[model samples]
Target: MKFYKANNMKPTVAALFLLSLLGCIEACAISLNAQKKYPYVLLGNDYGILNENDLGGFSWGFKRHPFNPKDSGGNYWQCFPREAIEITLKDTGSSADDIAWNDNIADLKIVVWVNQHLVHEYGMRKRLSIIDFERRFNKWREIMKKEKYVCLAGDFVNYEHKNENGIDMDIYEWLFEKIKTKKSCDSYLYSCHPTYEAYLREKSKEASYKFRGISHG
Candidate 1:
């Protein structure tokens, strides 16, 4: 009934429309849907929950998961913060029992952590005795040196790093430096305030605190 020409719109209004459209496209690009095909990391915690097993030496970082949605339980991919991993490591198995606890850890070829670092061969080993697993692990260690950075599922820190491995490495480093600067400032604040916890507790009651709720995976 009524059609308006694009030329009729004011310059500012037209510019705003274009900006909003671009924003929507950028937002859509970042999100992965169930049917989309792209490399993504699966949450080890979710895997453990679905399989009824312990997390077992798994820390937070990038991991390779099945590209197919059906194989990955669902199309949803979740990333947890590094703080969550610290809690999981302590609460989950950390000793000999850890080895046999989660079959998925081995079967899924998910890298296991040894002394807070990735042991590539542990994930590759199949149907081997504990002694043999250790021996072969040693040999694998000799053959492969540890990567400077190992991002795995559950690690919240390096998810943003982009490199040939689908992360921007340089930009990721800059983010860490920014975080470090913030932490340094926080340390100074802690030193200045004897009752930092009291201050935080009071601040928590503020309107800003209420506005920011904990994010779920």
Candidate 2:
């Protein structure tokens, strides 16, 4: 199990395009197999959900896709070809443990992408209580050990707060501290650099060219 701190770095357009092409090719190949095998599971917040229009027919790389439904708690469980699972946790009542414990997902690799809302909320709103939050955090720790789950991306609102802040900021800090001690977890801080600036410049040039073409057309 591994954990990674979130960063502002974005993949280059060329890289994204190449990945899409590769994914399409892989999907085609998987479709040919009669007995499918799923080895990857994507777990994250709503941002992880993929719509039909996002990748067209190759969304799951299979001719027949798995049933995607929202439970009463408003969480989405989408299973794709090869039995790959994509879980989107929208509400506090939803628990990933339920999906992870399923007999079908045994011995499979689970990849998690968590956002700030899962652990901390903004403004004066409270989504999960302190006790519940700690309980869920402990549950994840257990899942990490049992399922060998790797958290690829996650952001715990790391900031100082006072008692009146109305947010459980200390818990987030505690979570960060605990993960840092784990040998399997690696935490990092990203600062702006020249390379990122150059990437942005290139992206701007590409956008300018597209906009000009559209205007001329």
Candidate 3:
């Protein structure tokens, strides 16, 4: 084979062309994934499931969750948007149950709900409570962060504020302002930029509706 002049095509020029092609491929892949992620609730629980005993405990935002420090169950992490996640804080002779009438738990159960539908439900032994609580909490937090719907704020009309724990505080606020402005203009839809309006127009009613669900989370 005849050797071509290696210097004729500079390595930097060849590298730029290759980089452009790779960037296009990456952009396409990202779009494809985005389409697959439909609007769905990232439903979760903080030991919030019903039992024969009282559904005990309270959730005052950012306030320490009310389990004793000694109890490992108090410190839990979970992953969610899992369709659903349910945690059973079974009564273990702590303060959760009335023990005078042989009320000790024979078994405790957790039932996870997705969109108000029961998706996963199970009766578990008392000893597994702490381990299960931690696992479920961590799982929910992971998925919630990824989706940005698990926005921690009081479920009020003006959802501009969010839980300080979020990584994208500024982005969330920006989106919040845009949404509020659009609502003020018209309940239908509006955008600050023509480009955004055009992109929103591309989305189907289903996708847009899903986005509304996301905003609430």
Candidate 4:
């Protein structure tokens, strides 16, 4: 597989990102025997079917069966994006449901998984300041240093700065910027675009927009 790097992105970081693809290949090899029965190994929650043509011919398996963390035997980890919490906290009214929702957000914790290995746990209650993000991001970097492969899968809301609900999504931008600027020979970071077409366009100037596709996770 050919890996493309942005003009500003470091070569080492781009190389590290290839480790993620290696992990996917390894996973597929492990399940080769079951390929007839289970063609695809669903990574994240089912959003919808992704067209192969849109993905540069890369196939991530079928989402025929619902993903269950328990069945993964420690391979699967749950991740809660900032948008999920923001949406839940939108109900500021004092209704019983609103109160329960707000309470859940207050106690929310996001578990990050890399190469099917648990890496870090971040709490939503922490201050969303730049300092906190940097500190947490650095901690993740440190943890990933020992790992050869990195695979991150989640509903990273990268379409807009704010969603239709008016919830601020600057967090995703901030995180992406951090990944873009950080220089690490042993660390890896993968930034998902809002759409496959957008990703292809960014990757190559000659990239053609044949069909619209879902955003990369």
**Best-matching candidate per TM-score:** 4
For model 3, the local distance difference test gives 0.26
**lDDT values for all models:** 0.24, 0.28, 0.26, 0.28
Query: How many residue pairs in model 4 have overlapping backbones?
Result: 1
Clashes of each: 14, 0, 13, 1
RMSD, each candidate, Å? Answer: 23.3, 20.3, 23.7, 19.1
lDDT of 3 by residue, 163-211 (tens): 3555212100101111111012111122323243344455566688899
TM-score of each: 0.18, 0.22, 0.18, 0.24
- Name the lDDT value of residue 73 in candidate 4: 18
Candidate 1 segments whose C-alpha is farther than 4 A from its true place: 1-36, 39-128, 143-146, 151-217
Model 4 residue 75 lDDT? Answer: 17
Comparison by lDDT, 1 against 4, better one = 4
- lDDT (Cα, tens digit) per residue for candidate 4, span 96-133: 34433322212222333221212223233232333334
